[model samples]
Target chain A: MNPRLVFKAALVCLLLVLLAEGVLTLAKRHAPFFRLFQNQIVSCEILDDLAACSLKSGRPLIVVMGDSVVYGSDLHAHGVPHWREQALAAGLQRQLPQATVLDLSLDGALPGDYLGLYAAARRLKPDWIIFEYNYRMFSQKFGSPSEAVSRPWLRGLMSQPLFPALPQTAGDKIKSVLRKVSQLYRYAEAFRDAFFFPSREEVINRLLAQVLPSRSLRDPGDREMLLKLKIKPHYYTPLLTPEHAGLQAVQLLENELRRDQQPHLAFFTPQNQEYITEIADPHTWPRNLAILDSILGSLADQKRFFYWNWGALYPADAFYDHCHLVPRYNETFAKMLAGIIADGGRRDHVQRLE
Target chain B: MFNGWNENIRAFLLGLAFFLLLILILIFGQDLSSSKFIYVDF
Candidate 1:
């Protein structure tokens, strides 16, 4: 055989093998991809889905929607009893003694994200929703709250392609498609993790000893620097907004609740004494107070609404750092919530429907 | 009747064909496993 012919035949064989491999890989993961389908397909959604399914079928949800603080970082990841470490259901059982508490919080969520969730909750008909606004809630500082609307249906309309509020462009369509593809990858990753990888708690435990070394979270200056980088700390990005934007977020959320006639409780999570003192200069603290006051005033007559200012509740030692409540504080916070649910709100309806 | 142009062209084409064939083999041999390692502790 001529050398040329041999080379051509070899090349063709290689091409066939590559094509076959591609086809097989695509076929095997197709279903998983479709199930997950999002940008940078992350396992985050898979976990969210599993939790959502449980909430949907088992009982009325008591969602705790907010940012990373809700995920319980200050609490030791392994099994150390911390804020969210306690099974919310068990705690609710002790308090309400009848209803179940289903925490649907995801770390890194903002007010806008919470609004998205609130809209979903409306459809699900959750009995109670706690809109826990941590320090990051006012980070945006956008002024002038958006007009309140009665229909929760319109919340995501503007952000999604279906709404005319956002301009639909070719680039946007491409981005949307890419996001879907990424989501598929994420689903696959999550599925893979579910089977092969260690649970998040386990992994966090292993790394915690090494990464966090001291019980003390990184030095305050170090954390502040990291926050400025717009990296590890999820709050920094949102905090960059003008002060007014942040306040607007709270106002709009309140207005939204009023329009939907949904019952909600908003709490400003406890920050360590350091963060409080650092921000405590008479000006900033009062400004923050004003924002919270304004939000409460808007709902003044709606006796159903409640607010917990941890600033007055826990001591400085109760914090992991400037912003996060340490684990001990988490237990205290959980107990506080339980007490409030048990005694503060409407007594006749407390677990009455259940 | 000793022209090198034809010989060079033939050699180049042969090499190109071989390269393509090798790629095809790798692609076809790819694993279809949906399972992936999220993090591996060494």
Candidate 2:
């Protein structure tokens, strides 16, 4: 081949890559570009604090933080009433009409993210703080727990426990830089989410379910498939362990809350026990729940914070998956949470008067 | 040698065209009405 031809081919490939990157960046920036096919594109503004978004000055403020569970991934396809934050706010407003609720939860938010959210939220002097506890999130490992501890913002906030520290290598640093610079690298996950998995029918069905009150969000065929599948007994064993980084991260959050003299509520979000029981060994399933409940219960007790282990509150069908509650159940859960918060507030008021 | 070089150049051009076509399909085939925000799971 001629050297000129080789150079031309290389140049074409480079141009194509850059063009693809530009398209992806545009899709990310503008919602209309990605929404035509009924795809739910997630775009969030980067704000320093939750209060920065919008706040009612005189109302008592409540801030809740957690992962996708709290962010309401299952409800995204559904319309307004089904969103967890919206439902919860509506419920809370009914009970405490003057209070404001700020949901700081995002998808894939770990305890580390909560630590940052909490730090920022504290500046706003919220009346109450609620953190959603999902056992599945406990299995996540931090990249550099030691380095996180050393950071000035995280200093005195996060601490390393018995979990192994994953140091940031030179390769990791280079990859991080590349991920930031390369649009394809940055939006790879979004691309997969947009085109892959959850066939078009499934997405349509979810929307239909939201509109039609009688229709189930999950397809009967999908439910039948899930029923036939069995999960490994040891799947949750790593997360059940006491020394996992996730648990330690929660501990760090608890410590910081205590030091700051902040009163908070930590609730164990409902899990699909029926699915767990079917997939996991009978002996191991109960043990796993027991271990997790004990850890969280003990932490709440130690910190004098309100805790509710509502893991088994919902029926098996309420879950679209092993973890996320369907929109209807999410609304019910929010109402229950609002009731609990109201009750806690009343009890505190009575105690203070006494 | 000239014939072999010509074949190689043709093959390279064909491959490059295929690659560009794939990228174009991905860009144009994308659904644009999605209102969902990105959620990160721990």
Q: How many residue pairs clash in each candidate?
A: 31, 22
Task: Report how far residue A59 has shifted in candidate 1, in Å.
Answer: 4.0
Each prediction's whole-model lDDT (CA): 0.47, 0.55
- Candidate 1 residue A286 Cα shift, in angstroms, is 1.6
User: Candidate 2 on A15-131: residue-level lDDT in tens?
Assistant: 667887888766554433443422222222122223443353567788777665666654553445535444444445555666777666655556665675666567667778888
Query: How many residue-pair clashes does candidate 2 contain?
Result: 22
Interface RMSD of 1: 12.8
Q: What is the C-alpha DockQ of each candidate?
A: 0.07, 0.15
Whole-model lDDT, candidate 1? 0.47
Tell me the tens digit of each residue's lDDT in model 2 across B1-42. Answer: 456666556756765896656655544333224322232221
Docking class of 1: incorrect
Instruction: State every prediction's TM-score relative to the real structure.
Output: 0.55, 0.56
Q: How well is candidate 1 docked (DockQ)?
A: 0.07
Top-lDDT candidate index: 2
Deviating ranges (above 4 Å) for candidate 2: A1-49, A52-56, A77-96, A139-164, A170-239, A302-304, A345-354, B1-42
